[model samples]
Target: MERSINVLALMKDGERFIFLYDEQSTPQLLQTLGRYAADPEMSFSWYDAAVLSQKVRRLKESQERTTPDVRRSA
Candidate 1:
């Protein structure tokens, strides 16, 4: 299957942050959010990261639930 880039964007308080990642890169994206939250200079906070992380996980879970499995049952 061809991997496609997924976009998750946030626009708050006149600031916009766009994240581009593939399905396989969700783990990395989660970690990146944490890093952003830890940076004292950045506007991103732990709350933002937590909320976005939930979004990411829910989106992935929904997709997995909808997609059909190719394997046949024994």
Candidate 2:
């Protein structure tokens, strides 16, 4: 059975972009990530996918708890 995974970071030049993906479609995700690391024009780094996913989940939960519900009448 297929499972969901997240792509938590993308690096280019001196910048890192943080992203959360509930699922990824590529069959060779790690290989693709490695290619990015090897590319001379780019720089790349990552957190362990499992660890980063967990962190993202916790942050989302915290944000949800702190954020006011807009639908509730004031």
> Which residue runs of candidate 1 sit more than 4 Å off their true CA positions?
none
lDDT of 1 by residue, 1-74 (tens): 66778889888889998999989899999999999999999899999999999999999998889867758432
- Kindly report which residue pairs in candidate 2 clash with one another: none
Cα error of candidate 2 at position 14, Å? 13
Worst 10 residues of 1 by lDDT: 65-74
For model 2, the stretches where C-alpha displacement exceeds 4 angstroms are: 1-47
Q: Which ten residues in a row have the lowest lDDT in candidate 2?
A: 20-29
Give the per-residue lDDT digits (tens) of candidate 2, residues 1-74.
Answer: 34455546644566875654443433344445556556666545343444444556675577568767868846
TM-score of 1: 0.90
RMSD of each: 1.8, 9.5
Please give the RMSD of candidate 1 to the true structure.
1.8
